[model samples]
Target chain A: MTNTIANIDKEEDYFLNLGPQHPSTHGVLRLLVNLRGEVVKDLKPYCGYIHRGIEKMCERNTYPQIIHLTDRLDYLSAHQNNEAVCLLVEKALGVEVSDRVKYIRTIMSELSRIASHLLWWSAFGMDLGALTTFFYGLRDREHILDIFEETTGGRLLQSYNCPGGVMYDIHPNFQKRVKECLVHLKKKLPEYDKLLTGNVIFKNRAIGVGLLSKEDAISFGVTGPSGRGSGFSCDIRKLEPYSAYDKVQFDEIIRTECDSMARYKNRIDEFYQSMSIIEQLIDNIPDGDYQTKMKPIIKLPEGQYYQRVESSRGEFGVFVESRGEKNPYRIKFRSPNLANLSALDHMVRGQKIADLIAIMGSLDLVIPDIDR
Target chain B: MTNEELKQRIAQLCADAVCTDTQDYVLAEIPANSLFAVAKQLQEQPDTQFDYLYSLTGVDYNPELGVVYHLESTTLHHKITLVAKTADRENARLDSVCELWKTAELQEREVYDLLGITFNNHPDMRRLLLDEEWHGHPLRKDYSNPQLIVDLIK
Candidate 1:
């Protein structure tokens, strides 16, 4: 059987389509993989399946209206997306948000980061056939969602961020609920390590798979945990502190291994770092108005404004080119997922077909983020 | 280097390039023909090693097409914005920096797909977000598909 298999396609490479609807893809991403037997010789990712022309739409919409569209780009990191737009508009208009607003935004951003990471963990575990891990991950994620729904009034697509500040003040129980959720997550994160991180089967499949060097990570513009895994210190939060990131004291998680397991471990360690950030800022929120006074009709000065935030997956940048109108001349989002996904083909080459799933899961791509 | 030093350095490097110290970043407007060379200098020079190309965007300036590149030096922690505009909109073309920064490959394709600006020497210069048979570049100001896009603002 082995001889016959080898003789059948000794020099020929076969192609396989892995996604566009497959469960492992996590979204509408299609990978055309060329395989020589089980080893993947080349991989090409075809995106834009969920392209809603968000950039084109932004040109037609006003400054305030554009915030909602950002939420749909990286829905998992919806708060961060909204904040990127708000920060851009605020900077363009020269509006200084109150300290209270800054602290609240930072805390909420960290909460959403935890929530996004949890969902990624659940889906990644499911992709690798660890069914029990999904339930464990989502069970802890619920507390964060509950906190979001209570304050932002939306579970997933929360467009809470406005140009001047958040849309509305936090709910009365926001602080207490956040503390409770943090307490719950701090206890539950250890269980996650025991379940998936230490498993012998997972280690064999993950360790040393999809080795992306530090040079490749920087060249491809891969940021967040995936970039940090390759020892590329590309954390926007640390480098260009936006919002209340300057006040927070948390270590930027970096792993020099440059493999799938390194990426996995980076994200796992980030859970503690995120929690620590939230813990520091949660109690120290100052007393002031949640929002500042702003003109009803928002129009940025005629110039280019760019703002970047450290989203859960990577650096989410909003570039606004204004023509001194209510609407922007051209708006482009430097989506982290798109940059991260661009590097997928480079990382997965020469690896087994099965390891592609592990590497992809480690990337934690949100397709709409890429498509937008 | 500070924005002033970087501006002077860039000015020295590219004689015709207009360098402005913007509020956020050092904005430099280079001629379309010399963009690739200036970018190469920006990347290769030890003092101005703008290794990371974070964002590449194509803009439709009515008759002229433009591409804006946001580059950063991870080692130096400074950013520079390069704007290159084509003289003719009909045949919108610019040099591809994918050789210098791999991030430009897909972004250039996106620019080509949406704004109709083709990147010369791009390995795979194909439509990214839109289909091949798509009639017009939807992001362009003049691109009007009455059947698809409704003029909500008007």
Candidate 2:
């Protein structure tokens, strides 16, 4: 009698710790879950287990070096992170990159976005017990990494973005390889839907589960695919059009279901949009310098600058305060992962424990990104 | 609404609120005590409905300490930046905006953990990135840890 709960027939809750090291968490994020039997009553995400104090570090590093540090935040969207800082520096400096540079950056950024989403799809599938998706998603992602490695020398960090433009010219095979990769991914993407999206078991697991209403998404400040899944329409690439985005033609995918399946479809559809963006610019890259010559040292006028980039996950904002110094006086990165992660509790409450995994998988959170 | 219109609307709401519309966002400096009221006006007032708090940070400038709140209107797609300062440096405090934007729950905790700026009425106020027994805010300009410091060159 003492061992069992007195109100088991009624309603009683107990805490279950997910982990600061579990594989399903995708990193060191520990989620404190309040459960009533098999159903979740509350979920609290405990972050910062891997927090490296990036903002504090950036406050000490020079402007150019900050780009490299950004690469470490959301490693999947490293190029996009680099672009955020570069845009801020460029705006502060008032230097215009050549059209060639803009085209190249946009193409590269799209490529990384696809790569990041693929990796997310892979890990997400694995999170939901579809281990085969790991092999397929990574198999296609490897080709994109090869392309990046050929040009940038680093696949993960890919610190190609600089203040005025990219760090180097695109490899001569950039266009041809990109076109070939597009051809392969186009034929292969539908196979993803066939394997997981259309599967009855997967659909049963995702549809109408972990519902996040549009209002709740906004109040939680969620963005990117997570918000788009709820019809939030906060895509920075379309709304603000940075780099060469305005010249390119692509649709901002939106789904009103606001369930785990909707979030799943959002990233899948983005792969098509990203492909279209790359196709529009593949052959149109202008002839010009890869980088605008810098003044040896970079500094900004005394002011506050904000730059938002559409990372694979969501809006990655960089807020820089400079008092006319080589290093920023204070640099704050408005991390999208943190904002998206904050809404997990609201989405998972009253859902089953297994549904929590599916919901968290659809959230597509990178622990490093959240921790940063 | 345009930046000028937003500035006018904010001015109409609070006579003492000072705003600087020169930067990308409509930046404003308001008294710490009036932070909750001004934040509510920015969120509930249909003309300036800033329903999103995308970013919240604490800044340590030696003797002075302050908080930065970046708000955005999801429907209108307009953004603004608000700053509130505490006269008490070591014991800095401000009203919490978690009720307005749920995202502030963790961000305010991070600010409190890193900069030692207390967010009063914060749902759960504790050290976010450090052990609960840890001492001193690591992000403060005067913060020094000889145990962790290393020479970059030499």
Candidate 3:
């Protein structure tokens, strides 16, 4: 062998920028990856590419006006984001919303959850090279969006939830359309399993990859399916039971596998759980006023109030510090995506560059939520 | 534990700690100096294992800068809020709890970026959501950038 061949440094490492604009990242997140050949030695995620300073804007806007701004963060889980703010205002003002409002809000939230997960499932499949799953996922998601449109008058960012309750009562055909969607979702879910869950290629790429321990999951504040994948039962829906979650019967999906496959399976199972919750509450919506009357000029007493709701991603928290004014002194959104994104570096280290895509897909990060 | 008991437990851990009952959880105000030690006890102590740091927020409270931490114990199913304030807004500093909870690592960086409050022991304490060369913290009450932020009369 030539001396030149022996003299080459095998341990040399190089840096690779995955995104500021890349498809696999799902958003405008930039990952600075340190690589030794194909293996990822370390990864640093650069966020705020889409940061609109939503928190600072919230301080300037009135509480009611701030609801729509939340829609822009995690647009997939827009309904849940609206609800978090509404719930905080309601709690602070001591407004007792009617049961009808509760049922409608709960149903809408679950519909949003299913829609969000469907998009994630489609995108995740595409990330792993299963293209057909995208069509199936989006096609099913349209049913829920139609239901939202008919009632809330907006498809994606409904902003249906006001402080006292929902924007208005559900539409005349709301129950019928929701039932039809549930029936369709139930039939199509098994097809999802057949297409990707059992595929040998997906199994090979997903299983035993990007492992996160239960302790690390908790320490890193990784909630939602990502935390549940590590057998960390941190489901805020089960823990606090806001809105009508306490009234509904649904299991919090937890997996002990602690890998990419586990997180994938957790979200898949959540699809059925979300449907069951809608089924339970759809027919039984109480007949009452949708919204409670409020003073035209709303002002919260001088204090800080925190409210958390289980969004599709994880625990989405809203902390409002009000100084007895219509405009909050300070508003901070404890976005689930930000907490979930923090764990990416920890999970992707030592994994191959290809597996990094699979892990990121499993995390289901909506970058606007992180940057906001 | 009840909020009262939780408040008392935290009081026992740090004598100067001021614990109050919020509508949802116990809110404890720990001095800037004792924040790290009190946080360590809350996590390591068997009775109050607040292992989950769900939310960490930086607030510019006029003359004082504060950080609010929401902690929950998965095993105990209890929650508490801790607030630590630094009066020196000009050069605000607090001990980083990223060592105790890994989630605080990025969150502390965010606090540093948005509010100009620095965490002493953060490993990678850099601007998170903004460019490194960005002029001033936007979230501070006093922060004003005429080009960036348009002031609307309330």
Candidate 4:
């Protein structure tokens, strides 16, 4: 047999357009990649296919009205975005939120973080070829969604977060139900570990797939678990404490491997960390007013305010420019997915085409988050 | 050092670069040419090791354009912001910070794409998110949003 399989004609370098439609690309993301046999030579990410110009649209809406819009940016972590925007607006307005409200917000945010990570781990597993993990992960996520639906009246886009505080007081059964979910989650995590974490196939596909050195990770602006996976200092619920995060006690997990598997394990450890935070906050939720009294029509001073919070993906930032109006003059979102996706070319430069999907899954690019 | 002492130090170091001073943070007005030297000095200072860049943003000051860098020291836990104001909107050039912080490369691309601010000596200051054929900077205040009306075929 010849070194190269002889075709009828000449062998041309094959180029395949992955998708603005494939499941692994997340939402409406297209990648034009050139392949040398099974190895990818070059990759160009084509985004903004779902661009709605949410920034421009926010300028046209009231500050309160725009929280609904932010929910759609990172649909999985809608609560976190809502909280971040609300925190900025509240800071601008100089309204002090009550302790009870703070605890509630903190609990909800941690729960949302767990849900988002579960979805990510599931998808990451599926991309590595463990299809059953995807279904199992979402099945757990569905329980969290039910809790969100019961409290916020929406599963994906919970406009539940307002400027002063949460939309309403938690229902009587909310705490009980959330506690039960936490218990269930704690019990379910070990099964997840057995099925996916311990599986050799999953480990081999992810172990050293996309390695980001610590310095390079920081330089490239990678954050959250991805950064922690590279041995960067712990950031979440620790540095820049928001809500009741300061009140909770939990260890920030870190791994120096800086590989795809490290990120996977970082997220799994964070799942347990989040559960610990949620359990502590939910049990000791103080009985008090859920929201502080503020003016109906809120206006911010003409200046610039920057707020940063640790979202499920990474450090999510909101830079709001106010012109002393009810609406923002200009609001810019520093999306984590954008930065994570930007590093794709660096990560996938020498990997095989199959590993490309796995790397993309590990980065967890929700296209709306990147394109918005 | 406190903000006052830090201000005094910066004022002495680059007398003309001190734009505004506050108790918590200092805002320095840096020229395009002197930006790199000033940034290097800031990193070298023993007390002030602004090794971490918190955020880099662009501001559309209409006729006068500007780019701002919010810098912080992880060890010191102090923060400072530097604003590089440009006189000519047509040119709107500033020194690149990729040397100080590698994160600035993509950030500079974002500022260039959204605010139409150019960075001198930037490695690749290409359009980041939007298409290259896109007509104007969408973030500019003057960019208009046109309303489209649909005609029913049925």
Candidate 5:
């Protein structure tokens, strides 16, 4: 894994731009790939195509308004991203949400993790030329979204988490539907191991396609399943638990193989973990208020605060500096996609160009998260 | 180790470094001139061994511009926040920590592109998000554009 990635005789290499519009990229991410025939001599990712100035927008908006902006950063982990801001505000003002809020937030976060991983699995299969996995993955993901729509009233961009706690109480059937979705996915996901994960073609394309050593994963600041694949314990949920994470007992998946397949397996195993978390907490959502009373206009005393949540992709951090005003003085979101994308050049330098797609797919990049 | 012990160890490493206890992390305001040396010690030292740079961001404090680096040890799991400032706003420069954390390669470039903070020894300090012909660092407080402005007064 510590193989030399020095200049590979660029005199004979040619350049190819993979995206800015390629479907395999997942968004308008362009990769400047230097290829010697089919083998990659070097790889450089060009991002920021979808930069919407969300950080700058946060400086102008009130604390509550910033939660909506964060939902756009990583739509897949919308609930968790919103939670990061809510947690930061709660910590700054010393506001304690009810036990009900804690359990509900944890449950929603896990549900979204499953939804996100399912979508990533679908796209990953498509990257390896197995389009059937796309349909199978999305079928399960839509059920999660259906549950989201029933509770949060938004399928994708859910601004459900507010300053104190969740914006609204869980729907009456939230538990029933979520349990059903979990049961269905729990039964369906293993079939994927046989159909896609066990397929010789898929295995051949992915097993050792890309290598991100534990050192490189840490040095590059890759988190979540991607970092876990390389055996780097960068899980914020485990290290610094917030909400009900400290209460739940779940295994942080880590694979020392440090390849594309390891990353794939990490996410698959995570699906089981996320479902188990929900199963443990769903039946016991403490009966209480959904949110703590917050002012219409929120203000924090001058200070700096940072909070991170384990989004489906990785660590979604909100770093805000307050000036005792409604709007924050400065805000910076430490997006996981950018940090994860940093590992690409090192991962695919010696592999073929086709492996680049497989590797990128395994990283499960949400480009909007990167561009933001 | 707790932050208090980490600060004591860092003080021994860099006698002149200003170590302040923040709510979140231990802040070590290293001198801009000795940033690289201090950073190297923080990375390679047995106790500190800050092998992971999770977040690197540039802050524009009007007349003063500073780089905020968040380092964590994968081995020990202790975290520290290192901040270095240069009052030279016209052509702000600091020694790059890209060699320490590979994640800084893209992140530092992003800071340079948006806030106009130059890294002295960065391998490739090109504009990452913006085109070659784009003008002004948009994230800076002084960089004005009517289209991009969100006026609080209005």
Candidate 6:
């Protein structure tokens, strides 16, 4: 090693390949980072190291069969993506979902959002150098997944959403188990705040780092809590009311600060909001059929339809162009992670190496979601 | 304003652009060249502050091509569908909305990478989610998978 170093010119700049393997990267993301003593001059995020051509696969599958593929896009919050696609197809076919189906889907989506944000909070803390919060966050998340298993029969990739409505009706004890799970999460979330949110070092590491102004955020099409942190009101649930969101009452959380801390605080705030939404929906489980009866051979009209829904990361849109066939003529998924990832080049332009990890965590780039 | 009034107003901006005016939204088709101007006007309007660019996607019309923009105004709470039709399949160049909405940049790149539609003056127009040496735009009808195409030739 010493001989090779001696043979190499001292003036040549060294490029550090940070990941597609680094633990702090959060996913299979590689950074071609130009460094000058830990200060990053240029950072390029190389993805598609995990692309599976999900869009092409969706084209081959039937309308109902594609729901399972959507489950894998953002696996951390599979229910949200699954519901997003199911509702798009339902809207396309002009199918009327039952009231009970709407309430149950609402409950499931919110629960998934809470689980995603909780994991993000823990992982974000760990990225900023706190290791214990990872275990704490995952411990609480396990309870939510257990509840999901009770209802959806799958842990992470819950293919619960179907075209007409859902795969099946909620289990009889679904409400009781979800309520118990909520009680446990509510108790554990406060401990998370105590462990991470108020920590002196965590605040110092995240505050004022990766400051995204409101104008910049809007231009970048950043959504979810990231755009909300910058004070752009981009919540699809609030903007375009889908499923049971119109009937439900919840606050559209916002923060005008537009910094890493604002982003962090927005997720923490969303955890409580998600819990509240789940509680309200679970308590008012309507009595009716779980799915609407539709034609066995489902064919979409020969036209273009675009539907957008809010996912855990941000606005997720499904654009389906049908040629009056069982399968979509052309389908496009505008996953929020991809849109949010676009701002990374601008966001991490002047930050340090350590700051890069913190900012990347704040952006929450799910690699498959981006690649798909 | 009601959906009718918004449609009428957009008609005033581009006569006969409104395609179908449903109860919820008004769909309009603008010339590919006029998309940027119409989108800018929508953003500048007091009543229709379509400041948020929700989604941008390209649709293939066998002999022709089209780009669709779904826009909404958070302040006004109105939704509009703007369509831009290219002259033919060979050349599908539309004015970039990146100057008006930043979200359009990545969206335009995706369309370029997938559908082979070029966005003039896009700041950093490059392959977003694909490899740099990837052969053809995957979403295009004529596109053949590199591996499959290679296997066929052999």
**Highest lDDT model number:** 3
Better of 2 and 4 by lDDT: 2
Order the candidates by DockQ, highest first — what do you get? 3, 1, 2, 5, 6, 4
Worst 10 residues of 2 chain A by lDDT: A2-11
lDDT of 5 by residue, A1-372 (tens): 333444453446789999899999998899999998899988888877888778777878998899899889888999999999999999988899999999999998998899999899999998889899999999888999999999999999889988888889999999899888887887898898989988999899889879888888989999999999999987888999999999888999999999989999999999989888898899988999998998888898887677888999998888776779999887889989999998888888889788888999999999888878
> lDDT by residue for model 4 over A300-330, one digit each (tens)?
7887787788889888888876788888877
Alpha-carbon lDDT of model 1: 0.91
Question: How is the predicted docking of candidate 1 categorized under the CAPRI scheme?
Answer: medium
Native-structure RMSD, model 6: 3.1
Error of 5 at B131 (Å): 2.3
Residue A311, candidate 4: how far off, in angstroms? 0.5
Candidates 2 and 6, the one with greater TM-score: 2
Worst 10 residues of 4 chain B by lDDT: B145-154
The predicted structure with the larger lDDT, 1 or 5, is 1
Candidate 4 clashes between residue pairs 3 or more apart in a chain or in different chains: A19-A30
Which residue pairs show backbone clashes in model 3?
none
DockQ for model 2 equals 0.72
TM-score of chain A of each: 0.97, 0.97, 0.97, 0.95, 0.96, 0.95
Tell me which of candidates 3 and 4 scores higher on DockQ.
3
TM-score, A chain, model 4: 0.95
Instruction: State the lDDT of candidate 1 residue by residue for A182-238, as single tens digits.
Output: 888878888898999999999999999999999999999999999999999988889
Q: Estimate the TM-score of every prediction.
A: 0.97, 0.96, 0.97, 0.91, 0.95, 0.92
Segments in model 6 whose C-alpha atoms lie over 4 Å from true places: A1-17, A34-37, B15-18, B22-24, B149-154
Point out where model 5 deviates above 4 Å. A1-11, B146-154
Q: What is the lDDT of candidate 6?
A: 0.82
Point out the worst 10-residue segment of candidate 5 chain B by lDDT: B145-154
Docking class for model 6 is acceptable
Model 6: which residue pairs collide?
A19-A30, A219-B102
Kindly state the fnat score of candidate 3. Answer: 0.77
